[model samples]
Target: MINFNRFFSSLPLLLATLAVQYDEGKTESNAERLLKFGNSLLAQGQLAEALTQFNSAVDNDPKNYMAYYKRATVYLALGKSKAALPDLKMTMKLKPDFTSAFIHHGNILLKIGKMDEAAKDYQEALRQDPNNQEAKTNFESIPALKEHIIDAGQFVKENRLTEAVDYYSRVVMYMPWNVTFRALRAEVYMKEGSYYKAIDDYKSITKLKPDSMAEYLQMSKLHYALGDLEDALSDVRECLKLDQDHKQCLPHYKKLKKLDKQYSQAQEFINGGRYEEAIQKYTKTLDTEPDVPLYKMRSKAKICHCYRKLHKTVEAFKICNEVLEHDEENVDVLLDRGETYLIDEMYDKAIEDFRKADEIENTQRTEEALNRAQKLHKQSLKRDYYKILGVKRNARKKEILKAYRKLAQQWHPDKHEEGPAKDKASKMFMDIAAAKEVLSDPDKRQMFDQGEDPLDPEEQQKRQQWGQPFGGGFNPFGSGGGFKFHFP
Candidate 1:
């Protein structure tokens, strides 16, 4: 975490020491001084150090377009295209007539996969700097890509997908910077049911051609097919943001809204100890919206979860395997399958799936599942407390408390009927409470964090003698850990 960039960033004296003297009668502020020095550092190819100076300059004078432009330039050099976006946008807003800024920003956009946005920026650059070679080359390449795309489309319509794919991929390889060409190839990939490759292309296109409703719609559908409901919903929302109320978007928007509601209702039912009802609702939702692959697969996954909770292991395993056959990399289905395996005492099988899930996405939930799977396999009760709270190491007191409270409400036994749901909730409620009690105390937390069990019998006895004892885990502490999270 040591910021080496800080060394050359704020040290104004370094500039003079290096023979980059300030001009006489310069009455500019610290930010202006920093900007000039940062530009010089950039020219010298000291990128990281230059970034630090630019950051300092921005902190001192946020209104300085020159500082933003310089910072954006550094970000571009570092291949951090997204990092450059806000600064480049601010630069454009502050100095619309700066043709070079437009060209540079457009190129950055192109590199980052915002094809449509980059095209617009390049066109603007062309209007202002007609003879600009970079802008002209980029702008002119787009139409040629479009022509190639049309030829590829002819092959697509004739059901000659292999030829279409071959042709498009070749064109994209040649016009590597023409993002649209890659997008066309991605569409062909999707048609061929090469979902993983198509998803990859969709991801790039969405990033590159963000404002284009076509790209968003395509990505949304692909993600939906892949059982990535949240990503699908996100793409839909982004499309809606651009189109407002376009006719093509309204149906998708409405369907997603309904699906979201149905999904939430099913979750509530599950939490309320109505597993059968939840399954019914989930199934109904799936049946009603089979077009949205996201809802269909997720509903199936939830059905598996419900079956597992209901101790219908055979059914749960069956559904999970069936779903996996379609979308093998779905983390949620993998997690559910792993859980079912764990419950069946198939710990190795559980661990294998959980490990794969964790490798795909290093989420807190998956890490705990992985460890807990291995732990039980080894006959241990040692929980990964940090993973339990959905946090990492070095978490502050308030952060621990916040996570604890959120999970407490989420798994409150009172929310469920007196059954397996309640039993599971009761166990987790106690564990979360115990985790909070141990982690909230400074000395106990330090001990726990340093590989010592603070809840051991000897420590418990000492605490009881000191007029304190661990409560039977029943109380619910309450806050949420997610904003855009949805159970798959």
Candidate 2:
């Protein structure tokens, strides 16, 4: 009205006039300072950095309504809805009439999967400003969502995990940020034995609700099942940090930490070549954490390795046998026992173990062990009849028969049932029968004892045609028993 626009038309003239009164050193209002910096960072999508600014503003001026509101929004932007709730509550406390703050809080509650709390927040927003279309829409949608959730729960109660999983998966698709939906799906996955997928969902829930000690504890369990010990340790540690008295977490954390320490000590002993101490420590750890299957198997394998290093081949074989009884597919134990057997010149047994390990998983190490064991086992067959029967070179006929009888009963194919063990038993039984045939024949036994393979077809036939019954002139298998062979 007074031609003010015409008076201030010159940009340079207006700036010069303001420079005379402007004080660069004046203290800025806390709300203004933080809000300005927060908005700048928020616009750049630097959510964590923006959160620092907004949070500072709220801390400095707790009663500032906009400070609480902005801080909550920043928290939500960071996908940390659990952190947003307190700020949202403060915003509500300071300014009950703020419809947008109500909407923001409702959305945050929905993100964290708190559906009923979300409904309440939306209802409050609508009460203050009935024209809030966002509030009405959210409120109207809740009942239908609740219906679907109830339907999912019913299927779960009926033990129909597959259907329940499908319903929850769909809900999660619509609300990917919802920890509740993911939690239900994770439970179903675990019930279905989809452990890896269960691990993923549990891990996501930990991120969605970082303060959820229960979720972290569950994640640690899932990781442990998958043989991820370090990840389990890390997750359980996080769970304890959130809630040290967490009922399931505290005991597991203590047990794992202790077990981890003991395992490390055993490894140290092994590295220092103290095989006996390492074996004892490994046995102790196994006894302490018997329920942890992965750890138990690993400890058993370690003990077997220690036995091998100490040249206690029989003890090593015994420990490995026990581990395989519980976990037949444990490749590490299989390889350990196989290597030990090969070095001990029990070639047939070595070949059996290496071949079984290769069948389970064709790794380079298993493949190499199998090839080497097979090559050596064939060569050992004709030369080491007494060794094959696990008897002394100068053993008497009665001793040979006793050893053969013991081995035969232990390695009978029928005794082994099916699978690799049965196959191995069948093959080893053939070797055992060959050993008994050659050792029991005085002609063949003398030839074998004199460092010849009487079991070799050419040699056995020549000896029989010549009727030469060795230096003792003893008919090894009582004449009639000479050629009659019984498989072990």
Among these predictions, the greatest lDDT belongs to 2
lDDT of 2 by residue, 61-169 (tens): 8799888778878776766677778877887888888888788888766655677888999999988989889899877877777777888899889989888888887
Question: How much does candidate 2 score in TM-score?
Answer: 0.57
lDDT of predicted model 1: 0.77
lDDT of each: 0.77, 0.78
Q: Which parts of model 2 are misplaced by more than 4 Å?
A: 1-42, 46-75, 80-106, 114-141, 173-183, 195-211, 242-250, 381-488
Report the lDDT tens digits of candidate 1 across residue range 292-347: 55567778988988987776889999999988998899898899888888666677
C-alpha RMSD in Å of predicted model 1 compared with the true structure: 20.3
The weakest ten consecutive residues by lDDT in model 1 span: 479-488
Cα RMSD to the true fold for all candidates: 20.3, 15.6
